[model samples]
Target chain A: MMLFFKECRKILFSLTFLIYLVAVIGFYITQFSHDAEEKISQPMQGCEDYGTIAKEVPELLMPEAAEGLVTEYLSGYYTAYPIGFYKEVKLSEKKSAKIAEIITEITGISKRELDGFSDFDEEGITMIPDGNGGYTPVVKEATLPEINIPDTMTYERFRELMRKADKIIGGGSQYSDDNIVGNFSLVPKTYEDALAEYNDIFEKDKITGAYARLFCDYMGIIVSILPVFAAAALANADRKSRMEHLIYTRKISSVKLVLTRFSALAATLAVPVILLAFIASFSVAKLYPENNTDFLAIPKMSVGWLLPNIMFSTALGMALTEISSQLMAVFVQGALWFGSIMRDTELTGDIGRFTLVCRHNSLYDRNAFMENFNEFLFNRIFYTVLAFIIIALTIWIYSEKRKGGLNVIRKNIIGKSKA
Target chain B: MEKIEIKNVNKYYGKKHALKNITLTIDQGMFGLLGRNGAGKTTLMKTLAGLHQKKNGSITICGIPVENTTEIRSITGYLPQEFSMYPNMNVYEALDYLGTLSGMTRSERKKRIDILLKKVNLTEHQHKKVKALSGGMKRRLGIAQALLHDPKVLIVDEPTAGLDPEERIRFRNLLTDAAEERIVILSTHIVGDIEASCEDIAIMNDGKILWKGTVSELINNARGNVFTVNVPQKYLSQIRKNYIVTGMLIQGDYSTVRIVSDAVPDLQGINTDEPNCEDAYMYCLYQNGCEVQGGDE
Candidate 1:
């Protein structure tokens, strides 16, 4: 342990990780082009346009008769369903139809023929009115021809079916009599009809948050992990030059070597991550004031959520690097951690949840930092344990491999004892 | 005095035999392990250093089993065949860092760093990164680093491989100086290094040592049987086919050849004398049932 500490001081403390800190911090703070721009282009009115179509169809069909049903359906559908950008590329009609059938089979909706619909143009979207003044979809509202089925199908399947029906509806012009009677003049007659629609997803007036802040927090995660790469480079620096044979043969044990190298590397990652977390928090609070920014709260999240995760990631990287080629090991682990950050939203269903990179980061929950210091401490403990476990596993694998090759214990003691 | 004992060492890298039935004992003072490339010299060194495990063998340095690698390593300094050091570190920094790893205190590391820097003649470039050093300086650095902890045993594999003749001589002198107090085992394909510096040497091939003893003993053992013949250049190949040609030199239109024989050649008058370590090395290799047929037998 003493020897490990000594080595860490010399190799890990060298000015190697400085570059990584800058890069990670730079990446996070840099302005990213977002898919939200598409939302911005369409505006908040488009959301209302969708809501308007659902509400007005039945009212237009029966002027004074059935107001409650149309409003209820409109409120229930729009309020209940959350909107998100679909990631999958547009599928062929046949593939889309097959997927739709599979979904409808389990959804209990009668298979409705999609005669005319436009997937792209929001203007093309329209609702069919029931003779009783309730709104229904004009084309196949559901893909199957009805049998009771559960609604467990994913949103992806639903969106795919919607897209398929939209293509057919836009290609031709056919509305059932029920839909024809409720046709809304406020809505477009074709795909080009609704040029200006209101967005109901998240109101533009109620800015949820600044993207720059999220961008900065993301950079903090990357910066904090820089030490790991620096440590890895230093750890293998000796090995690359053939000094490992000499160094290992010294009083240093394989386990000590592994730990020392990990410490240096992990510390290297921590320095920048911690600093950037504070900076990001401060920047968000000061620069983007419209969002009621909390600079003090923001820095806490960086230390809490981002730092530990970076350490764990760096530990994992160093451990692999110890056992394998340094370049390849760092590359694989770095890419994995990066992927975890980028895919965090998709993986956890919430961008705020702990990703592989953010699992133990000290810079996570800003609110926890100020309001519940104990909770903040608790969160730190929770993530620190998680990070420690991963780091421990990395050390175990590394030492085991360095002792001989992989499966050293199995090969040396176990096999020998068995024999 | 400490001794390194290799007992029936057999190493297998997943069934590809590397070292086979190797048994030897090395004591304090200079020793040479000579072999061609891929002849298991490195395997033997690695096994002794505890870098590689032997399938069946017990190696003990100074009565401590080689499996007690950490303890053995504490007293042993090894320079590998292809040594590498941290390129990003300057000469002083690399030595200081390695010194710390070898269990030297910071003050002790600092003291040793100065001594090593001067010893290797790298004092001027003490602040220069390792990557900027010349090959000779790097080898010198390898030597200095290996000796830093003042280890009881020093194992250097192919130490003079890429060094210029002057550097090789200087390094041999350094090894000879260090060997005065420690067990220094130098493995190399060069016969001159063994002949000049090693008091005792072992010649290994095909994973086994064919012969081992002092250079004088190796030469003395093959003394009487060597002969020289002056033959036409055209018939040199024919004579070589019939006799083991140990040395050859073209003199005018005639070729002078040295060969080992139990009896005088049938061709009549020819001068003959004692053989050197090189001849003894060739003779020992051939005598150990090498597939290469002997001419002038």
Candidate 2:
């Protein structure tokens, strides 16, 4: 316990901890604070916009998905999220013919017409006169072609054809079963839908519950990756100070020393995030004074939602840094954070089992979060367990380092560098 | 207490053998290991501290085997050849942190830190940040940290390498005081430290011990082999090509060079001189044919 506090004090005085604090606070301020300044109001009977919701209805989805497939077929390339980053997938003429055949089977459009439309100037960025001498670039949104699915085609059959089209586009496309409904099944909200969502904030969320989701959404982005710097810096601190030998020769067992240091790092890095959680919950309470608010809503939610990200990144950072004696942790965690956040374009609630940064970017989407609550729980639990596993590996690595067991590895690395 | 017994210890860093079939017994007192850089003195020290594993050997420190690392570590402390604490921590804070790592209780840490700070003569600088300390002050703090737990053995590698003459003497005196009750192994390339502080010393070169005995025994062994010869400046280079010139005093066109040769030098005005630790070490290295080139430096 004393060593834990000492290690925490050491990290608290480090420049990396300061950088971590500034990053989380800066993210909360820039991304979430101003956007949520105005409190949510009751929905009136007749507003022009009530926002959009995704629902799986066969009639609406069939035409829309068919039109989307035809449009991408005409665009000469497909946009896919193969591993999370946006990928523009271009198919060979042979594979393009396969997709055209699937499009024909679903939309009753001929394959020759799809090939003929290739030279057509479809919607894209076009340069226009800005009234000055310079040209202004304007984005023209892509309009899905009007393609009608025959009445003889079943919705299940249409889905299978879409699956075939996704496989042709190299998977992770909107046509895949995992994403088809989320992508093409959206419908605008009705008056009752909007009003019910507004009341759910009061009855279900208790006002602060809704705001807590938004808080984690914004804080999760920076928290997932920023903690890597702290973990890596802490892991490298002893050697940087030329104190590795002095500390290694001590009477403390490697298990106790490694675990104490890890706990301290995890706690210190969590300080700013937990502080901001309190501030966010208090802010929501102040905003909705007449209603009840769970003051611990953000704090509780952050523990389940954001804490895994903090622990996972930090443990992996320490393990990688200890194993390689380099900042490989930063690159690996950064890639995970990036891929988890970019796995889907719809930001409100589309949690995957492996999403490191599970996001619910809106205040009123309590239902969306609740719908995927089980998967969210799994993701958090998986990361939490993974953090421990990696930390155990870190303890082993540290023990080996103490006993000069890593000299063979270090020598090989040095020998390779020299060669 | 049982002596630290190391029997036929061999270690390797990859294919290159670091400590080759080394065997020694170190008892309570100041024991000096004199060697040049890369002589595996640090390796031997680390192995004794349980910070390194020997390939195939047995080591028992104070009746506990080195394989029992936690027990060995509890009884032993190590200060590496190059070390400093977290630069931002004050002197007292630095010592306390190390004491904590040594598994001392809070009150125990406080008491030991106070005693060590006074012993190392750094009590006045207790509140100063480690970054603000001088090189010698940092070295003293290193010693303080190593001795924080009051271990049975303290292995300090090259403790006075970069200290000024005065600081070196003070550091050596501190080591001598530390050796009163426990074994303190001081490893260094500087032979003067061993001659001043150690009753027993070992000379190592290329991971092999060339000689191990008392300080005077080593000097006596090299007595007849050490000679000072007056040679012309033009012939100095030629003389160096034949012998290991340990020291030289240039005087106009002539120079008095201290050379270590197995036999009498075939030069004018050659006189046998008493061998100091440095001359004895050079003579030992030259007799063992271990490339003891000491000219023009």
Candidate 3:
């Protein structure tokens, strides 16, 4: 217990921990606190511009979808997110012909005409005379040609064809099943739909739950990447200061030493987040004093949702640092965080099971979160288990290091750097 | 009666043999291990400290097998060649932290830290951060932390490697004082350190112990074999190549040189001299067919 507190003090006084705190507080003040101050419910007047929900309608307008395809094909390049990384996939002639064939089926345009369609339509602009008697050029808006769609094909059939097109494009194009719908938006919700969502937020989420999920959404992004810096610094400090041999020769067991450090880092990193949760809970309570908000909602969500991310990142840092004796864990965790943030397209909808950062950006639509509650539970629990497993692996590596079996990590790192 | 016994201990770093068929018994007091830079002194010290696993040997520290690292570590305190602690911690805080790791009670740590700070002459600098301390002060703090738990065995590797002459002498005296009731294994390439404090000395080269005996016995082994002769400056290089020249002093047109050879050369004004520990160490390495060079100043 004394060792654990000492380790905590060591981390608290470290510069890396200071950077982490600044980032956490910076993110909270910049991204979350403003939202907490604005008490706009979905049914209120300005809700239309504030929240955008995913409503997967059973319709796909052919002209709109076809025009987007033609524009992408004519541009000679496609934007995709294959495997959660942004990739610019350039197609061969054969792939371009395949896309043209799909475009011909949706509209009456042939492959030749589709290829000839320009990216923009030019409009003539008149010159404007300045007060100094010199002529200034005024540029006109350039618009693309609008295509006409036949009424014979249904939306479902068009979706099936687009899915096939996405497959031919290697699965990350905007036409892919995962992203085709994101290119379009649902019609604005009616007053009834808005009122229903507002009621759900009040009855189901009980005011604080709605705000808690939003807090988790923003806090999750920072938590996913910041704890790693602290963990890596703490793990590498002994080696950096040339203190490993002194500690290794002590009578402390590897389990005790590693667990103390791990718990200390995890707990310390979670402190700011827990404090933010309390502040957010109070803000929500003050906003709706008569609504009888569940004050425990934010605190519960912070622990249940955000704490897992902290544990996994910190544990991973410790494990990788123990194995490689380098700060390689930071890059690994950074890549994972970047991928999760990029793949989180449905920010206000169902939480994905594999994403490191779970997003619920809205304070309404309790039904979306409820729909995938099981998967969200599994995701949090799985990360918690994985964090423990990684911690156990860290303990094993530490023991090996004490026995001098793992000195090759340090030797190889030093040798390569010196060489 | 605490002692460490090693029976044919052999250790290898991959195919490179680091300690080859080593066998020795170290009793309570200061035991000096003298060797060159890469002479396996550190390997032997780490193996005894339970920081390295020996391949084909049995080591028992006070009747506990070296494989039982927890038990061995409980009674051993090691100060590696690169001595450091948490740089952000103060001297007293660092000692307290390590003491907690050693499972000392709070009161025990508090009392022992004060005593050790005074003993290492670091009481005045106890509140200073470790990074702010000078090299000599840091080494003294290292000694304090190692003795914080009062282990039965103390293994210090190259303790005086980079210290100034004054700090080195002070550190040697500290080690001598520490060995009053415990086993202190001081490993270094500085022969003067061993001569000043150690009685039992061992000379090692290429992972093998070349000689082990009292300092006087080692000196006697090379007695009558060391000679000094004043030669012209031009012949100094040639004489150095022909014999293991331990020391050379230049005066005017002639260079007075000390050589460890079996017989005196044909040079005039040759005089036999008493062998010091450094001369005896070079002669032992010469007799073992190991490459001998001038001391690394």
Candidate 4:
């Protein structure tokens, strides 16, 4: 174990990985600062934009609303309205209240509770002004708007309208007065959402330069692939150098070889990744001290998040290095990063979530992990076992290679087995 | 005492029979497994070194069964044909690292590295990376690493194939020094190397040993059959067409060539010289005596 650890130290503590750590941390800090809003908003001469895309629309719309959902206005907006807003918003308070009452009948929350419940601010309720631009008394507010509704109208019809609005919002088509095809008038709310409206009124344009883009692209490539390559190179050191024959001849069993190699690979990533994380966390903390974010709060960043994910990533890299040639393993890891970045969206935060390498990116989402510890535990257990399965697959492939088939592998493992 | 033993070894590659009904015992001192390339020399060496599995055979080294791979490996040291070391590692480091693989403790490995570095005369270049070393230095380093754990059986496959004549001679001398009490099975196609150092030699062709015994015995059999004839360049083509030409030396207008024939074709005053391992190997391969078990596709 000491010898194995020594080897791990030798492989992991290289100047290249250290440089990569610094470069990635520096790149993220200098480029994607926590103050993206401040830098993005400041250039309009400190003129505060009301309802910035992030502050207004995202906060106002239901958390489920897609970005730019209120589309009849801005280039970024997806549709004129959210389905619920289209159906619920245009109606008079009495009709909306009635609909709310019906919804509460099934969901068990009262109409009053449903009316006031906001996805953003728990206490705030949505309200519409009367024609005179005045607040109406609740007693008088109880009367339904004179829109023709059949006595047979059901909650199902209401749901169908909501579905249509959702489809429009999701479809990413601009909704204008000219394009309105049916009973729905334009969602009277600003076609340009408050956020879009605010950005138009006050938002500044900040263009990152070619050099910055170049730096980011280079650093991104290095961070995603270099350590993966190092791990791969280290993994096959034994096999490439024909040390397997000598090591297998010793007291070390084949199992030890597999395990030690794995540990070495994991350790290889651990040093650089942890260092990168530490640098990143520290830099983030330094740059955004006002947010009171604990960069390496032992319990939160280290244990709650980074450590377990790092372990998983390292194990994943090692297992990959074991099964495939070193270069292909690195390439697979690189492909996973590219696949994830391309897939990046609000819906899939870590687009590479499907990949073995990126499965742990959201390992412990504080908001979700806390609410569903058991579910999170289930996923962790599943992935941990999955990592081992990958390890087993690697071992099976390697053992077959060792048994003398002499198949062409992109990178030969010349090092001792990880076990 | 026999240091290594093989019992009716038979090995195959898919449908191709690489080794067929082979049996041999190796005692302490240098023994040569001589054959042309692809004559199953590597297969036999790897099986003996516990690198490759035998389809039907039992190989034992120092009373340890070849089936017990780890045990056999611990007692055996192998330098494969393609003698490679970690390119990034320095001479001493590569030796130390390989020593660790052979189950040597760090201190033990360090001590052994020191001694072996001197033995291979690479002590001065201990800090030089294997990649930076010349071909001769790298070969020496390969030998040094193989001898690190002091194994009882040392198997080197084609060790001197790509060496300057001086380096090859030096490497052979190093092998001779290390063969004190261990069984050294040197596998190569080079007959002169075996003839110079190896007391016992085995001639293999087409996956089977055509002849095996002392070199003197094989040479005595082919003594009178080899004849040297001075022929004009015109008759050189006719002689090659009729007789099995072993060697030729062209000087001025005449060519002195060695041919393997039952009797002199014409009384042209031909002289005869003693056959060396090369002569013996060529004479043994003169005719397709054994039909290659598997057709050479």
Q: Which of the numbered candidates is closest to the native, going by highest TM-score? A: 2
Q: B1-297 in candidate 3: lDDT tens per residue?
A: 488888998999989999988888888899999999999999999998878888998999888998999988899899999878888889999999999999999999999999999999999999999999999999999999889899998999999988999999989999999999899999999999999999998888889989988999999999999999998999877887778889989999998899888887777899999999889999999899886664323
What lDDT tens digits, residue by residue, belong to model 2 across residues A115-168? Answer: 666544556788999888889988877544557788999999999998888988
Candidate 4, residues A1-419: lDDT per residue as tens digits?
A: 75587576557565545654576566556654442223222223333432111221212222112112221111222333221111112334554454444333333445455433233222224455778988654321222112223335454553444445434344212222212211222122232343343343222211221112222222333344555655666666767766555444444455666677667655555454445445544544454455444444322322323233444544556656566556556666676556544432221112121222222222112221122334444444555566577667666666655555443342344223221
TM-score of each: 0.69, 0.90, 0.83, 0.68
Name the runs in model 4 displaced over 4 angstroms.
A9-23, A30-227, A236-251, A279-324, A334-369, A372-376, A405-419, B263-267, B287-297
Q: If the candidates were sorted by their lDDT against the true structure, best first, what order would they fall in?
A: 2, 3, 1, 4
Tens-digit lDDT track for model 4 on B170-190?
999988888886888899999
Per residue, candidate 1 scores C-alpha lDDT tens digits across A174-274 of 12221222232123322222222212112321221322234334554554455556656765666667766776677766566666666665655666555
Expressed as tens digits, the lDDT of each residue in B1-297 for candidate 2 is 647888999998779899989888888999999998999999999999888899998989998999998899888878898898889999999989988888889999999999999999999999999999999999999999988999899899999888999999999999999999999999999988999999988888888888899999988989999999888899988988888899999999999999999989998899999998899888888888898777844
In CAPRI terms, model 4 is classed as: acceptable
Tens digits of per-residue lDDT for model 1 on B1-297? 499998888988776888889989999999999978888998888777777777887889988998887788788888988986777778888887788778788888888878877877889999999899988999999999999988898999999998999999999999998899999999999988999999899989989888888889999978877888888888887888877777888998998888876566665457777798877887788778765454444
lDDT of 3 at A380: 93
Interface alpha-carbon RMSD, every candidate? 2.3, 0.8, 0.7, 2.8
Q: Report lDDT (CA) for all predictions.
A: 0.61, 0.86, 0.85, 0.58
Q: Which sections of candidate 2 miss by over 4 Å?
A: A70-117, A120-146, A160-172, A325-327, A340-344, A407-419, B230-235, B250-255
lDDT of 1 at A407: 46
Each candidate: RMSD: 12.4, 3.7, 5.1, 14.0
Higher-ranked by TM-score: 1 or 3: 3
Question: What is residue B127's positional error in candidate 1, in angstroms?
Answer: 2.7
DockQ of each: 0.46, 0.81, 0.77, 0.27
